[model samples]
Target: MKLGEGVEAAIHCAATLASVAGNSTMPGAALAESFGLSPSYLLKHLNQLTAARILESVPGPAGGYRLARAAERITLLDIVLAIEGREPAFRCGEIRRNGPVKLDASAYIKPCGVNAAMLWAESAYRAVLAETRLSDIVAEYAAEGDPRAFAASCAFVERHQRPQKSNPTKQTPARS
Candidate 1:
């Protein structure tokens, strides 16, 4: 049930992008550099976000990245799926059938409380994630500071970044 780091990184990167001013875009390298991460590894997460339609990349000189949509429309689950994928976290292996004493269909059917409980738990987990939009989290963060001010800081990052150089030799770091 453990999610990958890309899931958290994608969400943070997307949320940061959402805070920037409309005309500006932040490069993936800069985002990585801000956290001392390798650019190659970060690109994988960025590409996931792009595939999810959460970001649109601008190439060439003066080019970078920006959100494809408004912050309010995006959700934490969207970023999670973009990076970690939408696969169910808990895959029921149906181990109940693997035992030496396999029960008959009549004995194994519906009234099994385990399957029902697992279904209920899975639904509840999904429901909470569905309701938790990035905007809601941003709102909470903003309340701690000032939304406009935090956005302005993100704008500063966008404005101050240098163009990333293309590096053919760069490779994604192996996860430890």
Candidate 2:
């Protein structure tokens, strides 16, 4: 099954956001730059992720995107579905009924074997994705990925993450 390029971008962006500290966020432009993707192209997938509640968008100057929940709660399936939609990759057209052999509808009481097999494969594929959380991906990368690349990614996020400003009034107790 061929997934769209947007899926890759969304996954990478989510993994990157996992590195942001506290309520900090990374702009879509910076994310696009990090992966060498077009800003507009990546923005489309980012918006989809936001709409699906996989990621949250913060508006304004110090605003951008962050995960809506903990990375552990966001699965690869969530990101895939957010970008690719819920449709199965393999669609069965039922061509068996169209052939000149002219098998009656009653003759095809059982489901198409090819379709069944394809559906089974797709189910297994989705199951694996569902089992893989964004946090798992991030942890694996940090532990097993190239040290230089990981360090560079850390530096990039450090440079671009926008930490939300604290409200002093909220932090300080009122004195009557």
Candidate 3:
């Protein structure tokens, strides 16, 4: 089954966040630029993650984005659900009754072999995804070399983003 663009984006975005320097934060714009995406569009995805509690959005001058929990605690399935909505990839239409070879009177006696196989495969896919966490992706990412790209992405965010003054009344130190 083909996953949505949002799902792919979320996975990469989470991986990027996982790689952020300890003193740095990854804001939406930086993420967008890294992937040559639109800031507004990236924010939309980021909001989904925030709503899922996968990422926390910090609002203020020095604020940006940070992981809500450790990477090991976050799974690829979490990213998929955050960006793509928690829905099964395969939606069977129960085609057993539609074709010329319609089901026999005893069809209800047992589930067709095809249905059982599909269900089993889907469950296996889910189990695999559940076992693979963002930390796992991060390990793979580091192995590929050049983690500095993530730091650069954060720097790009800092350079291009305007400080968000959420309170207006309260002042926040500008991010360096």
Model 2 whole-model lDDT (C-alpha atoms): 0.91
Per residue, candidate 2 scores C-alpha lDDT tens digits across 63-133 of: 99988788888899999999999999999999988966887799999999999999999999999999999
Global lDDT of each model?
0.73, 0.91, 0.72
Clash count list over all predictions: 0, 0, 0
Error of 3 at 91 (Å): 1.9
Candidate 1 or 2, higher lDDT? 2
Question: How good is model 3 by TM-score?
Answer: 0.75
The lowest-lDDT stretch of 10 consecutive residues in candidate 2 is 167-176
Candidates' RMSD to native: 8.3, 5.4, 5.4
Which residue pairs clash in candidate 2?
none
Residue range 74-165, candidate 1, lDDT tens digits: 77777877877777666667777777998777766665477678778867876887788877776777678777877775566756544445
Model 3 segments more than 4 A misplaced: 21-24, 100-106, 146-176
* lDDT for position 126 in model 3: 78
Tell me the tens digit of each residue's lDDT in model 3 across 41-66.
78888899999998878876667776
Candidate 1 is scored at a TM of: 0.78
